[model samples]
Target: MAIQFIKKITFNHPQSLLSFRLKTTSSQYVASRFRDATFEKFMDHYKNLLKVISIQDLILANPKNNPPSVSVDFINRLSQKLHLNRGATAFLRKYPRIFEIYYDPTLSKPYCKLTPTAMQISIEEAAAIQNTHPLVIDRLTRLLSMSKSKTLPLRAIFKVWRELGLPDDFEDSVLAQNPHLFHILDAHEPNTHLIKLVGTTPGHENFTAAVENWRIMECCKDECSVDRTEMRYSFRHGFPPCMKLKKNLRAKVKEWQKLPYTGPYEEFTNMKKRSKTAVMEIEKRAVAIVHEFLSLTVEKTVEVEKISHFRTWFGIDLNVRDLFLDHPGMFYLSTKGKRHTVFLREAYERGCLVDPNPVYVVRRKLLDLVILGRRGLRSGDHKLSSSESEEDDDLLEMENDQGDIL
Candidate 1:
């Protein structure tokens, strides 16, 4: 389902209305030591692993199935239906511990069965979902609060569920159950929906505080500045420890950072808006909102463009790639996986998130199970080795060539 945004919601004031435009710039695909390689590796390793889990879940949920073991042919067909380029046979062989491969000698065919370990993991994941229900709601609250219209199209929300660490069908299961917190609106497009926060303002106290804190830090750095060129570099202290800066690159970044900007949360609706100034502020606030959003995530990072879906709502009418390039100290853009993702520099240290969540721990454990299965297969420790047909060569294709996936 696609979200057909009929019109971007704009502030009534003409002063606030600016044509959304972004200046195109060449991107330097850079890597940082604090890029949370483990998380990235897990996601890459499980890209198809999770697909298998989703398939298993779908099969198990079928009321007609008694044992819930789906045939290999059924999984192959389901893979096509789900657009899973990675064939089910390869996936089962890749993660034998999760998917019990039962072959009937007479028929010479394989049946995909969920292993006990996988079953246990499902139970643990369910428990984690139950435990983190409140946090998930709070996460939803913050997401809605950050939007300019204080609402998000349901289709957009669905796309970023994995990044948000939300369970499948959360809109129906979790969101639908909470009528007092969220209101689902029927849009002109059938099955397309909009989600609005109930009785809540768009402004979030935490985001406001973060903006103030950043300002205070900037001011303190300004006091010790040597010159205009050096003044911009003064804020380099805010950069994460892993950010190794080259002198020439540092100068270039400082010059870009010196551009005048306004806060994302500030009342720009009444201000005399210079197009360049408004754009800079909008981009800055986009950064701030993203920073705050990531802070609330179990992992303090998200797909770069996933946050861009709120561009209209956030009043960000500029290229987000420019923002990441200009503000390397604040955010780290990683091209590790299929998508280029943005990570909060300060929130991560030594390839791991500095602030870890319990739910993340549970998820990590589940990931470990998948990794162990792969290890077992690699080591030939498992007797379930089956030569499966290979496919999904582009399963790891880059999601976008530029920053416009938003």
Candidate 2:
């Protein structure tokens, strides 16, 4: 099946002038390794936060939404589906600010519902998604543009839809509404489809990569030391403080920084993967592609496994895990939960997203509710003691420090 798909797509293009300049001596080096504690903690928090959000959505979508509550017994029956390591009741109780437990006199049983604050925040989140509809369309278009075939599998897009801030009915509401921009075609597999750009021109081909914009901004700053051209191709690195670079490694990194390669939006179809230089350029282009994708994401992170679904669609002919692991300075792989997540290191500071988008800002309010726990409860509500909250913080710090270096 994969072979058939590959045969159908052609990745040929006229060689660009930039291709000849990259055919220089290429030095081989082992993958550079480092770890950031801050990003690990960020991922750790999201591990449970994401599960909580999923459960919240499930409750909200229930048919019995008149009271917007579900029986404890019902939730417990689907504990495995919720991915809860603990009992459903216990898990729901952990975040009192988001979930409230109450006894129903008529039903004579305990039921869970979103707290008032959580419900309000949920409304705001919906509003934010609605307001950012245009941005979501633009992001989706740029993503398809980055692919070698100017198209991507609908399944692949669905996997990262939440991260891209796409609406649940984006296929009908967004794509269907923008017929001039996108077209959905049936795939060879049953129930599968492909989303292809409707009209791609030379202007679309010349769109600037996210990293290139960052470089341009840096070059405009008075304190910038690197040349504009060098910065354009080079990636920003945020190595851990504990990492000590050897002289040889430093030289290799310097050489890599100055290496010229095609941007993620540009095509490098004429370059063969046989030579060392071509191999290096291809690897760098993969980094650029992943970097640009994360840049388009609300959190600047995505599960490593989710990206694997795009290997064929994106024309990335290498292991995605190794690609991220090879470029630790540009990316950080966090094994915090069942799935590993890749983060764009430059997009974060300490532990927060450096540039928070509107959708992300609304989503963070939901996370803040989870982090608040029982403290956000009102009078007569279940609440944690101050000491218990402190204990929780200590445990989180301990977990964050575990396996600090990778």
Per-prediction TM-score: 0.67, 0.83
The 0-to-1 C-alpha lDDT of every candidate, in the order given, reads 0.63, 0.80
> How many clashes show up in model 2?
0
lDDT of 1: 0.63
> Candidate 2 lDDT (Cα, whole model)?
0.80
lDDT of 1 by residue, 1-406 (tens): 1233323324334443443333222542343234433335434544555566577766577636445677788788876665466787776787767777777666678777777877777767777777787777777777787676778888888867766767776978778888877899988888888998885423444444344555456567847444544443123325544457789977765555565544444444533666866655555556666666766677676776777776676666667755665676777666643566776767666555666776666666666666554542434556534434112222222332122222
Q: Which candidate gets the maximum TM-score versus the true structure?
A: 2
Worst 10 residues of 1 by lDDT: 389-398
State the RMSD for candidate 2.
10.4
Q: In candidate 2, what are the lDDT values of residues 213-318, reduced to their tens digit? A: 8787899999888777777568898777877778987788788888888887877685745798888888888878888998999889999889889877777888
The residue pairs in collision within model 2 are: none
